[model samples]
Target: MASRDEVECWLTDMDGVLVHENHALPGAAALLQQWQDQGKPFLVLTNNSIFTPRDLSARLRSSGLDVPEEFIWTSALATADFLKSQVPGGSAFVIGEAGITTALHEAGFIMTETDPDYVVVGETRNYSFEAITKAIRLIVNGARFIVTNPDATGPSADGPLPATGAIAALITKATGKEPYVVGKPNPMMFRSAMNRIGAHSENTAMIGDRMDTDIVAGIEAGLHTILVLTGISDQAEIERYPFRPDEILQGVHELVENDPFLAEIND
Candidate 1:
């Protein structure tokens, strides 16, 4: 376990730990500001691949959070980074929004549908049947299937919406190929974020709400994990999971009160 004074970096889930229901969670903004004031490196991680980092940063700022674009990491970015490492300048048939498209482009991947190297799927509000059909055809043509995340559903103002994992399942059923998911619970996403910030797992801390995705990934990545109750998992649900977080808090407010970054502040 990493001590409070030993933590030199922070990796946190964006939706649940920092903001929920389009509002910043209690003490989220203050804790983030404190991290910045103390020059602690941090990144806000998310499995949602609908929006680009800039778009997510704007959303957070509007909701009273102050995370910058560079501090935000998405599953799309992780997928792109992984693809780039495997096959540089590859072509992909993508079925996602600006987030996936932008990340792939920046990573030197060419977006194509004419016998591409990969069929990449991410979250999108416009999950068109035509696009899915194309992705199926591409996978059938020997293109590798990749998905941003394995989350079956995502939260919304209305209700839960079918996410990338659900859509990836449909594609898998049609093509008889399982997608390589690169998101939370995979640990690849966490390791990629750690590499991005040049932080070691022993000195980094992770905060999240979901025990399945966030906490499990953190544990696997060898980081101290804190599970907050502001999002998906509640106290009762946590008991069902065999894994556990290093600490549990009601919200970021409690974390602020505890002052995990006190050593940095004092320094």
Candidate 2:
């Protein structure tokens, strides 16, 4: 693994490492500013495919983080990238919002219901029964199944809401065909983000809060991994995972205050 000082690019989870509940975490602003001031290559990543990069950037601005749309990468973008590579100018029957649709459109993918190349599913609050039924029928008829993420549930003020994974399971049961997930824990998401920044695995670092998704994917991608305690994974939870991150901290604040990478930049 690359040491902190050797790292030249960064990939960080958005919700846990930088913001939570639409609020920027401690040192989150400082860390981002420091990266920008030094012209460091970095990208904020998320599994949520409900919002476009522009939408996420505005949301981060509302949280007091000045991340731009180009600096943000989402599962939808990665999925689009993958599909474009596999089948240029392909078509898909999609069940998602502007995030997924816009990305596919930008990739030159056609959105159609008739004998599409793939059945793409993403995160959305409104999971219409009719839409899901159509997706199932298409998959059964030989359309390839693809999902943005494997998150079974998403957090909300009320309770856990069914997410892409849950819906994917339903479709899988009906069609007896599993989807190719293109988000965290798959390592393809991190690789796609790195490719966007022209970063190599040997010199890239990933900072995240979840042991299962972020840390595991970082390790699989061969990037330096740092686990923070501000979100889902706790010390006890870390033990449950067989693998471990290279470093652990209370939050991004510690990186802002004492990271050797920042010190090297100042020097």
Cα-based lDDT for every prediction: 0.91, 0.95
Per-candidate RMSD, Å: 3.7, 3.4
Off by over 4 Å in 1: 257-267
Writing each residue's lDDT as its tens digit, candidate 2 over 131-165 gives 99999999999999999999999999999999999
Candidate 1 clashing pairs? none
Top model by TM-score, which number? 2
Q: Can you write out model 1's per-residue Cα lDDT over 151-236, one digit (the tens) per residue?
A: 89877779999989999999999989999999999999999999999999989999999999999999999999999998988989
**How big is the positional error of residue 265 in model 1, measured in Å on the Cα after superposition?**
23
Per-residue lDDT, model 1, residue 105, is: 99
lDDT of 2: 0.95
